[model samples]
Target: MEWSVTNLACRRGQLRILEGVTFEVAAGEALILRGPNGAGKTTLLRCLAGLTPPLEGQINAPEDTIAYAAHADGLKAQLSVAENLAFWAAVFESDRAHAVETAIATFDLETLRDRRAGALSAGQKRRLSLARMVVTGRPIWVMDEPTVSLDVENVARFARAVEAHLARGGSALIATHIDLGLPTARVLDISPFTKLSGRQTDDPFEEAFE
Candidate 1:
């Protein structure tokens, strides 16, 4: 699926944080968001994912086409890796066992599939969170720092997973500071849009990522 954001203006509470933000992500492509912390990258992504309303502009995406992966893992601590993936697969109304099995294989979580989410290492937990994106079966993926705790090897695995996604005509909009081995991805810096207030906001929502 293809989606776009045009001339977006957004706010966090009463604070106007960004304006004139624009970008498009197409099937089999990735749009990489690059900007300093507190520059409203998270805020912009939140709006695009429909978690919050934008102050102005347009988003051209079909309802329920996007799957969001937040900075936090958003996993159940007591659930095992396979169980966590299964839970999300059910939530997204995708094929249950098939999606869960594919996610474990794609993320190399088979060995840890039965381990409790909270018991996994940091990188392992991150992998499980990312695997949830796979189980969603949504065409578009909107991720916020999806690789935070991953090491080099796992990062490579993640890159391959994304490659496979794009190969299947899936699109991704990701916010990250480090390179994820995506040479075809384009970078969009949101810094200038922070000029709405001539400075980043002190709003806790923006402060969290800063």
Candidate 2:
């Protein structure tokens, strides 16, 4: 899959989040979106994921070809780990048992498989959310702050999983302050575009702070 954005912009109230964020990601390639807090990284990711519309410009991709994982785990706080996965799988019409099993093993959630999602710690919850994405197995992954609150060991596992995904010809666009441990990944900074008015300005995000 290939994703292309030209002059893409987003706004939050009167604040300009992303502007002219022209970029592209092809299959098996990883692109990192790096910037400070409130630099429009999350907004850009949301736009790319089609969860939120870009006020101006365009973001083009295949239908149902993208999977998005935001900073929030997006888990139903009331459900058990297994129940949550099962629910999502059924909702998405995915292979429930296989998806849940793989996610449990990948995130080391075997012990917590039957535990309630609300009872898991922050890191565990994040792992659960990430595992949901892995199970979905979409071609393009757009993640915002995927490594947040993860310990060193979990972070290493997360990076390896990402490598494995790329090896399989999948693509990812990640926004994070942490390093993703990919040698060929390119980092783009969206800070320069923050000055643009509204979310639709024509200032393309700069390539910086790799």
Best by lDDT: 1
Q: Which candidate number would show the highest TM-score if scored against the true structure?
A: 1
Deviation (Å) of 205 in candidate 2: 24
Off by over 4 Å in 2: 196-210
Computed on alpha carbons, the lDDT of every model, listed in order, comes to 0.88, 0.80
What value of lDDT does candidate 2 attain over all alpha carbons?
A: 0.80
TM-score of 2: 0.88
lDDT string for model 1 (1-210, tens) is 788988998876666888998888888999898998778888887888887799899988988999999888999999999899999999999999999999999999988999999999999989999999999999998899888999999988998999899989999988999899999998988898885454546577556752
The C-alpha RMSD of each candidate to the native structure, in angstroms, is 1.9, 5.2
Please give, for residues 42-127, the per-residue lDDT of candidate 2 as tens digits.
Answer: 77777777766788998778788788997679999889998898887777678889978877887888999889999999999999
TM-score of candidate 1 relative to the true fold: 0.94
